[model samples]
Target: MTAEIVRTIPGAQKRTNDPEGMRKKVLDVAEASFQEKGYHGSSLGDLMAAAGVSGGALHHHFPTKKALGLAVIDERVAEAVAKTWIGPVLAAASARDGVRLVFEAAADELEKQGFVRGCPLNNLAHELSLADPDFRAALARIFRAWREAIAEKVRADQQNGGEKGIDPERFAALVIATYSGAMSMAKTAQEATVLRQCLAALPVSGQPAA
Candidate 1:
């Protein structure tokens, strides 16, 4: 289920009244509203209403619906974006552990957010990718970052005694693609189990040569 709306926490900024904080609040509301109602379907009034802001406030922050959507994508990239592979990849003392931990952590994060498997990058890409070149490029950057971050972690593992004599890059791709597919399924089913199963299916690496 989508999270229940509450007063903006203002953690990202000093005050709820701050311009940046208020802008983020607008994006947060827009994301939920967009998820409920697609970009083409959702009216500016809907986002404004969800944010509990006047047209003046929304315009002051985002002058147009496309601008608001862009802000939403930016916020997703900076925070609350669901490529959880980063944390576990860094946590691993070993390469094999890094692979498992990264995928599993991804699953755990998805479940924690409850039923929403909304990856902001994927959400916008699936919708506006063909229509808007700018939107497509913005989301593509995040997607690239997500993959590169995992790839870097695996590369780091090689020097750190993470695993001995294995193809770290290929393994990174497997883990990333695995989690991405799992997240997509979870998004479709609206269930966390899909993610849990995907991670669980990952082969435990670092095994003795068979």
Candidate 2:
């Protein structure tokens, strides 16, 4: 039976009557699982067990594994990028300064978390981009959104006479590429130092603090 039909089951109704809550729970569990295990490595069974939901409940929200992964990308990963990077960069005085601040903040977080895993978008892109066209498109959208956000800020900074020498598009690409590469290296080495070094070398047009 479909998840909608199975939701009528007495136990299912009692446990997950709130559709939004169930969906969020599934996304939360799936995001963690996918980040830890990659898309292929994580299975529907693992999601069901981690989310404490039955097969029917899982299917009700996400009909297929690909659907679930895309939802996680659109919802969880996109929200994370907006919150962590886009928002902060937009709020900063200049794009270059924003890049510096965001990287420093991210470095602090990585240090606290021990830096074993890398960027979620990068991790998934490496795992699923070539294997699935849908995944590639979904991830490409996120990366584009992220790059556009930073690029917009960079353009604004240039117009405001902050850093006219740098190309906004090129700078944004550099920031993303550098961070993604550093995170991969950090994950491989199981060390936050790699990330710190990369952040230190970022070509942000900001002066080091005295």
Q: Over 4 Å off in model 1, which ranges?
A: 1-21, 95-99, 105-114, 165-168, 205-210
Residue 66, candidate 1: Cα error in Å is 1.6
Query: Which stretches of candidate 2 lie above 4 Å from their native place?
Result: 1-20, 205-210
Cα TM-score of candidate 1 = 0.74
Q: Which numbered prediction scores highest in TM-score against the true structure?
A: 2
Over 1-210, each residue of candidate 2 has an lDDT whose tens digit, in order, gives: 554544354555434577666888999999998899988999899889988999998999899998999999989999989998999999998887788888888878878887576789999999989989999999999999999999999888877777778788998998999988987888888887876677667777344332
Model 2 clashes, total count: 0
| TM-scores vs. true structure, each candidate | 0.74, 0.87
True lDDT of residue 165, candidate 1: 59
Tens-digit lDDT track for model 1 on 58-173?
Answer: 89878778888777777765354444546655666755676667656656776777766466556667888898998888777777766676667667766766555556666667
Best candidate (score: lDDT)? 2
lDDT of each: 0.69, 0.86
Clashing pairs in 1: 95-162
